[model samples]
Target: MIVAGFGWRTGANLGAIRSALASAQQGQPPVTALAAPHDKLALVSPLAEALGVAMIAVSPSALQSSPTPTQSPASLKARATGSVAEAAALAAAGPGAWLLTTRHISPDRTATCALARSCTEGPAQ
Candidate 1:
């Protein structure tokens, strides 16, 4: 299904997301996922294996902690974040690929449910 499963640490792009969905519908190839960055391995490895999807790990060591500001910033810097940069690179390489979110929607809807949603293209909620 070309499901690119990832986490909040895993960046997703609209182009890639669309591509993954199209590829899944076409059934021309297995879902292509980008493994979470190396630092995120402890988190994404098991989930990726459980889903049984094809993934290529790139710059796994690039994952680092980022802080989200709750208050308005004095300046609007266009600096891109971690996974977002990865997703952009992927988008450049291949458009319309879906990058799965690493963040869980809920406790019950973890690995399996997320995978199901990718396969079924239905809401996991």
Candidate 2:
């Protein structure tokens, strides 16, 4: 399964979220789900619906253990993750998942996206 994860600032609109995901998805497999912090489900729900993919709410505890390729001071300070987008994707993709891209920022700079692929190939919830 391929998962696309997002991290966004307050007031980020659907356009910004979509732009970031598009940028991150370049050369990647089709995304089966969208993910975001459990506390921030609203951040990714709209995009998930627009993409017609499943939504995965990642827990803070899960983010804590998932290592990311990129570091964002704000993300690290606020969520204990080097990159919220990367961490969310890795966590939601489950065991043995690896990032396909680090993070891609939206044109508006209000959102970011990262992609990760699961080790297993069956359907994902």
Q: Which candidate leads in TM-score? A: 2
lDDT of 2: 0.89
| Candidate 2 residue-wise lDDT, 58-118, digit = tens | 9999998999888889989999889989999999999999888899999999999999889
Which lDDT tens digits does candidate 1 get at residues 1-125?
Answer: 33443333135343333334333234233444534434444554554465565454435222222222211121112223333323322332233333333222222222211111233443333
Q: Residue 80 of model 2: what lDDT?
A: 89
Q: TM-score each candidate.
A: 0.34, 0.92
- Each candidate's number of clashing pairs is 15, 0
Clashing pairs in model 2, backbone N/Cα/C closer than 3 A: none
User: Model 1 — which ten-residue stretch has the worst lDDT?
Assistant: 67-76
Q: For each candidate, what is the lDDT? A: 0.33, 0.89
Residue ranges of candidate 2 with Cα displaced over 4 Å: 122-125
lDDT of 2 at 45: 87
